[model samples]
Target: MTVDPEYASALADGLTIPHYVWGKQVDPLGEIDNITYILLAKDQEEMRLRLLGSATQTMSIILVIVIFVSSTLSTAWRVFRQPRSVVNWCTFVQSSSATMAFGFGITMKLSTACNCRWAIWTASLGQAISGICASIVLVWKAYLAYDRDRRFVWAGIILNLPEPLYLYAAWMHSRTTFTPLGGCTMLYPSWLPWARFGMDGPFNVIFSAAFIVVAARQYRKHGSAVWGSLRNEGTIGLLILTFSNIFCLLLTATNFADEYSMMFWGVDWLITNQILIHQHRPMRRSLHESGRARGRNRNARRHDAETLFHPQPMSPSDKFAQWAELNLLQPKSNSPLASVLEAPEPDISDIGHTPAPNTASHLHSTQASTGYW
Candidate 1:
């Protein structure tokens, strides 16, 4: 009657929980030199939850990659459109956030003893760098917005500092944990699988809170609309930042990393555009203004009609008809977006559809009909 070492060890350790136990091959020298393998039993109940978490993590990674590439390109594209402003800097901040949440978040997220120590170092450093970048750029957006509102700018103070310190601090912390493919994180020395819990967890909580607070405080007057810029652009940054922080908190709290890793990936992927695109206002506006300037207006605007019909101008009727079209189609200056709205389709009786009386017929008839052409 031989005692099994696996059960015997667990019993000796006073352990009762179930776990995955790996058994080994036993040789013929059973009595004197037996080389039997053993494994610790795993809890069956945790199987499904942990599996789901793993799937979620996979998806989260895919999304992060998408975000990284897309964001990089988006900023690049903006470079061509708005060469004057450092818009890419602001856009890159959003990109960095998406990268950190799924990239480093997952690494610290999977900080098990089995994970290589080197990975923890790199991921942690990467996140720290990303965070530093994000914070600076976020602050930059506020600065730019305020600059736009108030013409004065403090160029000297703004340009000479901050990033160097950010880069140096991130590098120093990262040296503690950097290994292949694995991201960096603090080395925790705890049994419950949350050794670096104190170091990493607290920062996320604090930063998230600060991000939301700053965004809220700065935009209090504008409510994300920023008055001059598009409404969507004003609030998109805050929304993305808020969502990232909230997800980070949730992941930490529920051990989702331990259970639904893939779900996190999905979230990371979605955020890339949400966060960065807010900075694409210049692009969006450029398109709108150009379209307006170019004759996209359905009225068939004769913007260059004066030049076209130079010396011998056409009859006043021809001019009136053309002008009528422009006046009718000219986008409302007060609201550039008013055209997108569906105007109450002109009822036959309500007027716009009524044919314009020929100018020669009667001035009163033309005026009374509210004619365009």
Candidate 2:
């Protein structure tokens, strides 16, 4: 007589059992023994959970791809319409790298779905590359916001120069194995996973924190005007990156890589969208100044018109002269001058006053004087 390995394994684990002889109750020493039905049910339930988790990861990857595509198009359109700047070029690089990262992540997820041996290798390599790109973005933003020393930027760049070699090492050391749930999963030496996480995770946290602190300090020192050039979208995106990294660290520490791999894609999506939106919108102060100038011009025009058409009461001499002309300067109806004298004297009380300066020109001068433009 033979027993299923699964049944034997279950029994070895001390799961409850029943003894019987041809459907009749028997002593504890009965030759027929079986694992409880509850054990089989539990195994089925575990499989269901795994399937649900996979489905969730797939949906998340799809959504991330959609967001990446839309944001890339938006950024490209904005770049085409607007004059380029250093910041714009940096934004383009960051967005391009993020899009590549998302693409690789999608590929890794698809490979995993197919239960390919390469899935783990691809996932490891893709995530490493993506992490490197994300780090570059954060470092660049930090340089823009706080670091004055160009050497620091160069140093940071040099630090990441070996990422390709590191990734190659990770791939070379990884091995493929069969797994009941994921199938053909790639397994890294225990030290390798921790080493990768150790290098990437702490740096991610530190960089994110540094970015927030630097931005906040700048905001406090210069007020919101500093952000006029930086854009709120970049600040908000940094915040999102910070929190997402914290979450990713937590998930990785808890050994939930498969359950939360989608977070990597999400971070890239956030970065791409932030760059796109920030580039599309103009600076806030410029918009405000333009509106204010228009308002001032309108008010000036109104005041000038009132002064012209509704001059203050005429002086007594002016009034007397006007009355004398109307009553004493009578002329024969046939005279050519009669038409000129008979016509009501044109009101010229305000004509002597200088014409109001051009309101638009005045406002423009004021803007220049105040540096509002």
- Alpha-carbon RMSD to native, per candidate: 18.3, 21.2
User: Once superposed on the true structure, which residue ranges of model 2 sit more than 4 Å away at CA?
Assistant: 1-54, 78-126, 146-148, 176-186, 189-240, 257-373
Q: Kindly list the per-residue Cα lDDT of model 2 for residues 135-218, writing each as its tens digit.
A: 565565555445344654775676666567646654565434322343224444445444554555556556555655654565
lDDT (Cα) of model 2: 0.51
lDDT of 1: 0.42
Worst 10 residues of 2 by lDDT: 28-37
lDDT score at residue 264, model 2, on the 0-100 scale = 47
TM-scores of all predicted structures: 0.38, 0.46
lDDT of each: 0.42, 0.51
Compose the digit string of candidate 1's lDDT tens values, residues 237-338: 555655565565456445554423323423533553455455445433432432223223423345456556675668999999889877665655556456
TM-score of 1: 0.38
